[model samples]
Target chain A: MDKEYQIQGTRMKFWMPKEVDHHKAAALRDQLDRLIEMHQIRELILDFSETEFMDSSGIGVIIGRTKTIGFYGGKVEAVNLSAQVKKICCASGLHRLINIREVAENDG
Target chain B: MTDKKTNHMHLYFDARSVNEGFARMVVSAFLTEMNPTLEELSDVKTAVSEAVTNAIVHGYSTEAQQVELICDRNEDELTVTVSDRGVGIADIPAAMQPFYTTKPEQERTGMGFAFMEAFMDEVRVESVPGEGTRVTMKKCIGRENGR
Candidate 1:
């Protein structure tokens, strides 16, 4: 499986795809979980710079991963969210579950 | 005042997860003539995606089936309906409730109906216990500021 994530020490930053519907969310879920386990990820950062669309399935992917890593007090942060994605994150009550950063600090 | 043209389309495809994006694209493409705003297009696409995903994930549930998508535009109002002849819902009210999902293991957030209702002007669901489910949603374009 092609890795869609980057790992540095205990942190993993995942690059979200352009469209995050059920089909893509499923694949992302599996890959993200596997990467989290393999790398023992503690801090997960979802980079939404490329995401233009997202539905409830994408919300499920985020919540599922949050629960997985939350068991060990791991944190999940989302960055560079677009207007459409921000609305979804708030509407699904995901804004409270994870930290959403409007701009990436390092600009990588 | 020139009369606005009315248009309609019917789409039938396999109830597979892969077609979810195709359904959204078709609906957006169909609405291009209306000159929808960016937010308007995004809202419709999101709602359509939710409805189609529900049919494939909940209605069919691993069984290969057919999903039907119909869209009609009369004036500025757009109507979209997605239907499936697979296993239907036992209680639509319970199903529409936020955070109520039968496939928790699959990580379903159960917010499908909610998103449709939120983004669209109106949403209606019809289902027969053992028959199937049809979701119809309506939205009025170019009226965001007026509303």
Candidate 2:
């Protein structure tokens, strides 16, 4: 509930917290799944602008959402990933599943 | 190779998801003595987080248990060991394989061992069925060449 959510028509955007681990991932999975079902969201954008640390659990959250939304012909895209988060994403082969925006020098 | 121990700490906490961050904080704070670079710090934190998570989720599996975390620093090298006395893994090799989680329903990508191995210079796992699992990882900090 502390996480922020934005909805614009069928697209939904979620702002991740400062840390994305198993504890947060479980909560995120529940909330995002509910939103996706209720709003019939076709496009999901996970904004990691504030995330400083993320482990495999973060990977699970993204993968879970990808599968959930993908079934409805929806897509998941990640934006503003920090270098540390990006490393985990790439290392887990998550880059191949969803569209991940490159991190800008100014973006955290 | 001066392996003289510089510092060491041990932590025992309930195997719960909430303590994951606590474990990371303790390890990172302990490593500050070496003045580790941001990258090195983040790598070890991620590796530690993964190990602790596995102990909570897979090892205990909704049962209340204890997770033991041990950290030691020898010169530029830091070693971390996370152990749990819960349901043990029967096959270590299969469990370490990427994307081979036993609990996919919970969205476990089975990448816990992979992340530990990826971020650390060395990773070793020891387990006995019906006993427990211990994951020990070592990383050399302040190295000119990156891992």
lDDT of 2 by residue, A1-108 (tens): 565988879988889889999989878888888999999999998889889999999899899889988999999999989989999999999999999985422232
Candidate 1, DockQ to 2 decimals?
Answer: 0.90
Give the Cα RMSD of candidate 2: 3.2
Taking chain A of candidate 2, what TM-score results?
0.90
Per residue, candidate 2 scores C-alpha lDDT tens digits across B1-147 of: 756658999989998888999999999999998878888899999999999999999887665799999999987899999999988999999999999998898889899999899999999999987789999999999894443
**Per-residue lDDT of B129 in model 2:** 79
The TM-scores of all predictions, comma-separated, are 0.95, 0.93
Q: How is the predicted docking of candidate 1 categorized under the CAPRI scheme?
A: high
Position A30, candidate 1: lDDT: 90
Predicted candidate 1 versus true structure: per-residue lDDT over A13-92, tens digit per residue: 89899999899987899999889999999999999988999999999999999999999899999998988899899999
TM-score of chain A by itself in each prediction: 0.92, 0.90
What tens digits encode model 1's per-residue C-alpha lDDT throughout B1-147? 887779999989999898999999999999998889889999999999999999999888665789999999998899999999878998989999999999998899999999999999999999997799999999999896563
